[model samples]
Target: MAKQFPEISPALQEFILRQRVFFTASAATTGRVNVSPRGTDMLRVLGPNAVVYLDLTGSGNETAAHLRATGRLTVMFCAFEGAPMILRLYGAGRVLRRGGPDYARLLATEYGGTEPLGARQMVLLDIDLVQTSCGFGVPLFDHAGERPTLARWAEAKEKQEGLEAYRRQKNTRSIDGLPTGLFEEDPVPVG
Candidate 1:
């Protein structure tokens, strides 16, 4: 069975909170589509129609670059432990650079002004569609806890070249050569 909703219902929000991982999909008008697995407790549901995730430094900045080229983004969550359900949120998303207005507001209100290590930017999605489907075929798995590898890497990198420099070197462009807007935006250090 499948269902669609105009906004995120309370039940859906609870389901989202319970999940330890989610996937993000994005693409420009041309080139390869990007789908990436994300975790690390960086996402927040602000309201029925809005959600945001802290974008950490990674091998590539495809999502930000794709969002800059095209506002469309999709986030998906699946029930791997409990009920058999899959959720998808479709929306127009935008990148909130480190010093941007939306980023500042969200950081203060939702994040308590604490920016984690390796945080490059924030992606805010104004959701327009919410869909849920049966995940009966999906295999069940136990939660093994989040990995500390990324945090440790970020700490070491911050101690070395600094996150900003790393972002400049690796996160400025998508694999298909689209600008991620990181270079154009002047990001101030978050205290």
Candidate 2:
């Protein structure tokens, strides 16, 4: 049976922490709906009603753009190893750009001041609803390991065109023409 909660319960938080992979979904008022699989040790549950993830640089920045346009976001996690369960968090999201106070504080306090090579921004979700369901139809898979390709690419790119330059070139706009707010001079407000 599926269940829902107003906020993330303790058990749900533990489940989120154990997962190695999660998926994010968002969409602007128009255009395509974006759903992306995300990995790496970059997500954190700040409280019962809040979660944050370090969004690495990618070929596209749909989530950031979608949040900027609409503020609606959902994050889903499925158990791939043990129990058959799926958890989804529904919320409003905001991007915390690099150099912003919230970004800096989270980097310092939650992440030991270590920023990943291709980190573009942090996405904060003020969760409104938490839901769980039996994931019996989902196939289970064993964890192989983290791939080093993205990290290597980020390092090389930083040495060449530079990560900031690359962001300007590719990540500033979504495929559907929405601004990603990546390079705005003003800091994004966070709550």
Candidate 3:
């Protein structure tokens, strides 16, 4: 059976915290929808109805562009190891750049205790709906270690060229030419 909630319940929060992977989906008002898998230690629950994730540098900035264009987002997490369940958070989100006030506050609150990673942006979601479905068909899999490539790349680029160049060259416009923040000065890069 499926269930719905107005916000992330306590049980849902526990499940979310235990999950090692999740997926994010977004789209502009017209262009193709993007669904991307996310993992690592980059996700955080901010409140019962809010969450944030560090957006690492990637080949495309579809999520950021889509949010800028439509502000709609969906984050889904499937239980592949424990119970058979899938949780989906439907919400609107905003992007925070490295130097912005929100960015500085979030970074200080969430990760300032540790050395900074070369995270380019942060996607802060204000969840409006929480839905769960029986994921009976989801396959169980053994947990593997995290991939070190992205962190390595980001670390290597830290204080170097930065991700701005990459964002400018590859993330300036969505596939549909939606006006993303890429062209603006100190534009926020998407994950």
Q: Best candidate per lDDT, number?
A: 2
Off by over 4 Å in 3: 113-116, 156-162, 182-191
Residue-pair clashes per prediction, in order, are: 0, 0, 0
Q: How many backbone collisions does model 3 have?
A: 0
Provide the RMSD of all predictions against the true structure, rounded to 1 decimal: 4.0, 2.0, 3.3
> Which ranking of candidates, highest TM-score first?
2, 1, 3
lDDT of 1 at 50: 91
Better of 2 and 3 by TM-score: 2
Which is superior by TM-score, 1 or 2?
A: 2
Tens digits of per-residue lDDT for model 1, 103-166: 8999999899998888889999999999999999989999878788989999999999898888
Deviation (Å) of 80 in candidate 2: 0.7
Compute the lDDT for candidate 3: 0.83
TM, every model: 0.94, 0.96, 0.90
User: What shift in Å separates residue 94 of candidate 2 from its native position after superposition?
Assistant: 0.4
| Residue pairs whose backbone atoms clash in candidate 3 | none
TM-score quality measure for candidate 2: 0.96
What residue pairs clash in candidate 1, if any at all? none
